[model samples]
Target: MQRTAAPRQIAESLTELWSPRIIGELDDSYVKVAKVHGTLGWHSHDNEDELFFILKGQLRLEMAAETVTLSEGEMFVVPKGVQHNPVAEAECLILLIERKTTLHTGNVVTEHTRSLAEQLRSV
Candidate 1:
């Protein structure tokens, strides 16, 4: 069976904050959708770059050098080894494309951080 991925609809259905639901996969990456509010701590992936696409609301990707603001329909790529924190003033719906081995919050493990096992759980 060929299943289609509806990012916006899946995002709107999400009830948890900063918890990403896997929707699809391409080669070595996993396509994930998440509803986020506030911040997700500061961290970095030493070996993988992360791509973020905003599906609704707004987001601020704060890196050590500068902060990049993303609105609906916008996307940004956080290069590998750059420390960053994702913050949202209002609730946000987003799609994340990351490597299969990428950690939820990278090296920083906080209460909000979701493990790979948790991220892999059925939504």
Candidate 2:
């Protein structure tokens, strides 16, 4: 079915924290939305770059070298193999663009790590 997805709507539908739900797909990539708070563990995707677009609240990206802050309407791309952690002091909504093969937590498996099967489920 052809339809339009609202990131905020998708995000609001999420019941789990830090869990991403697939909203759409584009070629080899999947478009996901998540409602996140607190911190996500540091990890790196060996072969896929991750794109993060903030749809609400604030986000802080902590990398090995520096930290980047993103507010609503901002976006950032973490290059492949770059280790980084994401933190949100308050509730934040984000849209993620990642390859279909990209792991939820990259090389590190944390309690928050989600399987592709989990992400693909209806929100």
Candidate 3:
């Protein structure tokens, strides 16, 4: 089947906060969308980098050394092994590009941590 996904729409339609839904795949990567607010725990991917694109609202990426803010249409890539925490003051829509093996919350398991099976389910 041939289909196209509207990332923003998919993200906006999400009913769960901090839960990411898989929308598409590219080679070894997965394209995902999530509706988020508040802050996600600090975590790091030991092997794969992660990309975050702001579809709506803003994101504050706090790192071990510095903090970066991204608004709508902005994107940033967090390098592998770099500890980061994503925070949003209000509800935000985000698109995530990451390797299929990348864990949603990296090595840390918290209340917000979601399993691959959970993330792969229909939104």
TM-score of each: 0.96, 0.97, 0.97
Clashing pairs in 3: none
Residue 77, candidate 3: Cα error in Å is 0.2
> How displaced is residue 82 in candidate 3, in Å?
0.4
Runs in model 3 lying further than 4 Å from the true structure: none
Worst 10 residues of 3 by lDDT: 1-10
Write the residue-wise lDDT of candidate 1 on 7-36 in tens digits. Answer: 999888888899998888899999999999
Better of 1 and 3 by TM-score: 3
For model 1, the superposed segments whose C-alpha errors exceed 4 Å read none
- Tens-digit lDDT track for model 3 on 11-123? 98889999999998999999999999999989999999999999999999999989999999999999999999999999999999999999999999988899989999997
**Full candidate order by lDDT, most accurate first:** 3, 2, 1
Residues 1-120 of candidate 2: C-alpha lDDT, one tens digit per residue: 668668898898788999999989999999999999999989999999999999999999999988999999999999999999999999999999999999999979999999999998
Comparison by lDDT, 1 against 3, better one: 3
